[model samples]
Target chain A: MTELFDQVRERVRRNVPVVIATVVGLDGSPPPSFARLGATLVVAGDGPSAGSLGDDALDRVVEADARRALLSGSSGLRRYAVHGAGDGRPAAAAEPESGGLTEASGPTLAVFIHAIEPPPRMIVLGAADVSAALVRVAKVLGFRVTVCDARPAFATRTRFPDADDVVVDWPHRHLAAIADELEPCDAVCVLTHDAKFDVPALVAALATRAGYVGALGSRRTHADRVARLRAEGVAETDIARVMAPIGIDLGGRTPAETALSICAEIVANFSGTPVASLRDGSGPIHRPTRA
Target chain B: MQDILDDIDRWRDEGERVALVRVVAVEGSGPAGPGAAMAVSEHGEVSGSLTGGCVEGAVVAAALEVLASGLPRLCTFGYSDEDAFAVGLTCGGVISVFVEPVG
Candidate 1:
């Protein structure tokens, strides 16, 4: 079990898909020691499984189902009929994707499958000082940070030491190359604050399914950028999705503080929470604390 | 689980046996979702959390049991568990926890 957990953590850190299937409930009696509750089997993308649920046939079925679940990133309970030794047949031979925990009439095996996939990626456009800070903060949040810039001098491993990858290419082009893999959990931050870089990058990023698309600019710059993006034929709905004049109104000026504001927005965006940043609040200076 | 890897690694490095507890299922308004995990060391140290203080005490007891017995066990905690009504989830959700010794 320890080895299984170590492998699970290592694989999750490396962005390798893995699933943990635990026998949480059992129906009907298998052999005296065949299937024990809480017996865990770890099926990972890298290699053979590390533990077992005390049954070979059940393990195989769970592994197959777990791999399938990892592809679409679903996690929940799975039910299989546990055919006893007297039946002399493999359990889970004709299992359905039963989701609920409701009782079953016949013998059943309930395995709770937990799928752990890659951490969401954050593509930071134009590796600036602020981008470096964002990379560090985003890494702490478990995002696979990628720093991209057209200028080779600006994008270097030394500058963005914490980023998972640093690429010297046009920001939009790099984003386009990796766009298909981007999901709603991912984020794209445009920190170039220059039209040439930020405009095209924002356009390409909005085209992707990344959940949070933020651009660093003043109110005046954002208005101009919106007009440019409209000229590029981006949809109004999508344009509205861009977090221009990016981040909450934290009144923070440092690069690290700005990055914190940006990442906080990302967290709120992912969790579907509202950002409570208003300049007109009269009461306490601090917002209500989060537990 | 990802956040507490450093602590678990440190416990292992110090030759301490450890047990991992994972919340495999949650029915209703549980504070945590599935896959939430906690690490318990042989020395009774803990890392991470499995619930919002709903059943942590009972879970630690189960984790310590796994550490001592060298065997895994599944535990269910909720208001329906009459015997453990005191430690039931305040949110009225049922959670299934899998406790296993780390290999």
Candidate 2:
């Protein structure tokens, strides 16, 4: 049991996607039995598994569903009937079955398929004070963070200890090099606050499939930056993707508070929630008073 | 569960029996979603959390009971049940948890 758990921990540490299916509820009213409560099975994306849910047919069914759950990148409880059927009726004996069919019933097995997705990637483009704060907050949210900056002094290991990677290189160059690795679960935050770094960094970031791309600056700065992005041949659609004047309207004053707001926005984006941002709301980015 | 690896290891080394309680399903407005887990030692020491302090006390009592019985049990916490008021989540959600004794 501990060995199986150790394997799960190893995969989690390596950021590999895996699914753990635990049978939480079982209905065996008529005797022969289907699945017992507390039975667990772990399935990985790369065709590896540990433990079992008693029956081979049930394990096979759960493993297939687990793979789908891993691909969907979400976790929830899934109920399946005995003999791998979806309908609450017994399967026919003579019929050629597809193994994952719902053969119109028996006892139901409720397996909670927990999709263990890799930590979402957060690429912080600029190793400034705000970047350090963002890196810390992102780490708390279980993000695999990478801090990039051209200046070697700013992108130091000691400065951003919580960051998973500190690359002392131009942000755009690093982003272009690793563009293929970026996915919908990844985020890119351009915090340079300078046209030189922000434009190129955002251009390259927008090219990737990163789910969230935000830039930190005031309204006037973002307006000027938008023109520069357009001048550099970036499409209007791509420009719209950038969350300028980044973060929620929390009226955050300090760097840490601003970082929290930005992190909250990123979460809101991933979770598909509506949040009042400086980009959408009409007002000063910071409140007149401390409130 | 990963956060409390060291504590679990130390407890196991000391020959303390442990029960792991994991939140398997949440119906609505749960503080934590599926896969949230906690490990409780024989002496009532806890490692992780399954809720925002609404049901931890009841979960601890359930963990102690599982350790005593040496059997796995599935417990549900929510406000819908009249008898479960003392252990239900204040966030108005139903959470099903599985408690199992671990080596």
Candidate 3:
């Protein structure tokens, strides 16, 4: 048990995608209660599950469903039935035991499996001082941060020791290598103002399904970059998705404050909050932080 | 849960019995999201926080009961409660916590 928990903890700490399925609620004759049905299944990529829910059939069904849920990045409660007929089959496969095949008459049990995927990935393009500050802030907010740059000297482990991965490669190429793994919770931040780096990086990042794609630059720099990207055949709609001059307009000049601004923008992007300076807002000093 | 794992692991290594309190849901303007966790050891040592100091003391009391009873429970603290033991959030939010023993 200790070893299992340690492995799950390590995977979670490393930001590896994992699903922990626990039987939270059950109801039926001899329903699996806390003591009888209490079990945790730790499932990861193409790996065997650890722990069981006292029934091999149920574990197999749940593990299969869990993999699908993990891929979809969806979490919710699931229902299953015991005994009656075709017990271990997937919910879709099990024919309804009621009339018209629309319902089941068997003893159904509810399993509230809370599938928690690892923190979303935040890919930072450009190994600048602002990148370092942003990486720290993002990590504190439960993001799996990766720092990428074309320059090896700038993108070293020593510079971004806290970063989950530091890739010394061209931003677009690095993004290409990881595009398939990027999810809706992921984000891309292009901090390199140089068009040589920012243009291709933003172009590639826009191709992914990352929820947030931001670029750091002045308004003038953003306008110039937009013209260049338009010349490169990027559609206006695609270009508009980029949060240029990234971060809220906090008039922040320091790297740390700038980092906060960018982080705040990311949160606002997720929560659908309007991006405005805290100074202009009349609410409390600090709002409840979310991951 | 991920943020407080190190503290919980260290306390467990030191042979301390720990109770874990996790914020499972929130209503209105709560300070934390679901899965926010805090662990309290047998000696009252605490790691992590469920809210922004708004309800930690109340959570600790609930955690002590969880440890003593060896049973998990769902606890709620909010601004509108009239109960004598009510510990409300200054932000006028309601948070539901799950208290369990971490073995």
Report every candidate's CA lDDT.
0.82, 0.82, 0.75
Local accuracy of candidate 2 as per-residue lDDT tens digits, A123-208:
99998899999999998887899999999989999999998899999999999999998999899999999999999999999999
Which candidate should be chosen as best, given DockQ against the real structure? 1
Point out where model 1 deviates above 4 Å. Answer: A29-33, A45-57, A87-104, A127-133, A149-162, A165-170, A231-238, A250-257, A273-291, B82-86
For model 1, state the Cα shift of residue A160 in Å: 5.3
**Local lDDT at A25 for model 3:** 40
In model 2, which runs have C-alpha deviations exceeding 4 angstroms? A30-36, A83-105, A281-291, B1-18, B80-82
Clash pairs, candidate 1, are A1-B103, A2-B102, A2-B103
Tell me the TM-score that candidate 1 gets on chain A alone.
0.80
Clashes of 3: 0
Query: Which prediction has more favorable DockQ, 1 or 3?
Result: 1
Expressed as tens digits, the lDDT of each residue in A1-291 for candidate 1 is 566677788887777889988777776644324767677888887788879877787788888998887787777888877665455554443464586666775667788888887889999998888999999999988899899998988899989888889999999998889989899989999998999888899989998999989998777787799999999999999898888777776767789988998898889889998885321223433346465
Docking class of 1: medium
The order of the candidates by TM-score, greatest first, is: 2, 1, 3
- What are the interface RMSDs of all the models? 1.9, 4.0, 5.6
